[model samples]
Target: MKGIRGRYGQMKVLETELDSTVKLLDTTIFNKDNFYNALGRQQDFIIRPLLGPQKIRVNPVNNSLYIIESTNNKQHFTNSEDVYEHLLKHEFTKKNYVIQTVPANNQSVLHYHRFTLHRISSSSNWKVVHHSITGGNELGKIRHALPFLKFNKVVRNAANLLGNYYLACNTIVIEILQNKMGETWITDTILHERNSKWSQFHSLYSCKALRSYIPHTELCTKESLGKFLQSLRQVVLKPCVGQQGKGIVKVTKLDDNTFEIHENKQIININDFAKLYDYIHNHYLSKNDYIVQQFIVIGKIDDRLFDVRVMSQLDETEWIITGVLVKVATKGFFISNRASQLLTLEEALIWSNSKISFDKCVSLINEICGKASVVLEKNCKGITIIGFDIAIDSNGALWIIEGNYAPSTAMFYKFKYNEMYETIYKYINKNKKRFSPHSD
Candidate 1:
């Protein structure tokens, strides 16, 4: 996060309006226990925009709200029930999490931040765009950023965290920059397609070349659930827009009346279809939109299932797979990111017990990943890197699970893939995309 704090450049800080829909929760109740809170565009800090000056704490029990002041005593209670279980199930997830050893009295609260410049300048840190844009975070933004953007990449690169990144469209910035300043900027990130799982699936499904690799995914409704389970026999139900393996449920149709739902490595079998549907509706799909997809019998290594994480970057013309890691789910857990393990592609494939040849397996993974990236990029221009989660089935078939726009390299580093980690950022270090002016 140091890199983002030390940002440079003469700029102006901008305050975006808060949406009426987002709850500006009282975060005082958030102690070291409540580590999963997000800066939902309601508060700010001059010194550090995301140190969260006013943390709204919501009482999970009564849903009572308290602002930061009342939470000073640090008197907080962690949800002792399903919260831990839920977190444990996602233990094997991607780099969004961290494992640290510190005294209970003191723990570091760090987050992954991204600072964007003219075209595409991003790091785990922040940078100065023009003014306090990310200021009192002023110094931080310069330190991590301008140096990289200003200096030559052949010499060095740095990593820092200023704050977390959210998917807020730049319609406001675009309007003023164009009509007022006669300056224009292209979208340097994923637009509409990646937000909804169904939308992303449909876009890729529309492409004939990629259609085969996509699982039969449909919006999960009462009708769709019954139809999908009946037709696909076994399927996976997940939130329409989410990352990692959070809230993913695997369902298997054992017989006409019996059904199995695998979650958090535990299987709950229900005999009645209506009851099973109710259980799922109340638990996994609670008031949120979900998709039921035909479950591919993903291959297993010993008792655990594994998938591929391909970090693909854009070349001047096409996308290239820059980094590869295998995400092996915790044993018996259908959700791959829960308590997962990381392995090299070859290592996982070797232990995967698939009859497929290693060479052929690697080739298929690369092929599927490449094609998926092409399809995703075609939908949105200015996309430079894609972190693709690809799955391999029992028959050695490759499936495109999903792609992440802002991929993390912490996994590569934590797994001691130093060489690979450095290589991936080196491409990003340059921030190859430059400001191209579009004037009226």
Candidate 2:
């Protein structure tokens, strides 16, 4: 009673002496000995408690109610709702006390921030849950068994207040850079200048070994288009910022001084240079930023072109390749993507019919990817994760197709690469490494 009296002494005295009412609430209403009086005092300031082991205590210096949760008692309340139970148990008691115990384990918050793209409303698509550090399975499982975290339906943005680490899950590149949560790999965009294709081209163009992998690409201009067509009998046109084969066109020069443009199932032939220019210029090139590149005949599997998708991440100081998938082009499609059938790296290698050994290819791919990552990390800030889209040509040489900052991992998951996926997330969420570019 003395503790409660001291905690609310100022407010209690103010109410008694003034013969007025006071109320306090936080996610729930606080009972004032007199219910009617508390209801009436709703018009006045109320002190509500935060959901934690913290109690509403008074700061005598300022005569204000402040939260007090002891660090020593955190382990006892690993399940946050234990705090609520403590509050409920002491609700009608004459005296309240918080039992403190030495913390045997420590846990930190990992907040994933998600929001719908192209939406006007500024609301959070947040899920509050605890992911376990260890589980029955080898892969650490999400702690859905914890009742408190499981039922937390509301989005809580108390990272700053609670010292939680925030992760920009599904957030755009801009958000990752702006959020600035301890220099992670998600923001590595060293080669991503304006778009992936061009950014990758310019970034890798300097390395002689990587030069062959990068096709002859340039911004689509009238003069450059003609030269590109004249030099390379066949050229591919792609949106500088395209994905999943959207807005792609293949142009082939014919013997009759005409051009054949293939897009999806439709093929158009233009005999006049001016007409061909107009057809491509207004309809495709001018619509958005476009890049024209020399076409390389990709290795095929049963007559279908296939490309490799490698997902890599920085673990401490080492870059680890987490997942590898081979994307076979969909029937009649120019690009290999989600719609295309995917095969394991081993299966794809067998289908590829390349002379290079699997071990050698793996070594080359890793070396190239490592070099790219180093270059990217040097210039691009906040990029800790990268996905490389690579192609193996008929000549058995590797070509760099594109680099992605926010690549999809569905392929890995779809192909049953759970171990790799789990490892990547475990590293990210747990983040056990002491090395931080921002660390002193």
Clashes of each: 37, 11
- Flag regions of model 2 displaced more than 4 Å: 1-196, 430-440
Residue ranges of candidate 1 with Cα displaced over 4 Å: 1-193, 432-440
C-alpha TM-scores of all predictions: 0.55, 0.53
What is candidate 2's lDDT per residue for 1-440, written digit by digit as tens? 23211223212222232211111111123443332232233222222221111233211112132222321122223322443455456432333322211111112212222211111012333322212121133221233233223223211221111111212211111111111121111111011232446545655664566776678887565655777888888999887677767888888889547899988767889896667777887677534557789988888888888988888787777777877778888777667863468787678888778766788889888988888776655435457788898888887788787888777877777665567677666656544244555555
On a 0 to 100 scale, what is the lDDT of residue 133 in model 1?
20
Cα deviation at 358, candidate 1, in Å, is 2.1
lDDT tens digits, residues 88-147, model 1?
Answer: 442223212221111111112111122222111222122222211221244544453433
For model 2 the local lDDT of residue 98 reads 28
lDDT (Cα, 0-100) at 248 in candidate 1: 86
TM-score of model number 2: 0.53
What's model 2's lDDT at 242? Answer: 75
Candidate topping lDDT = 1
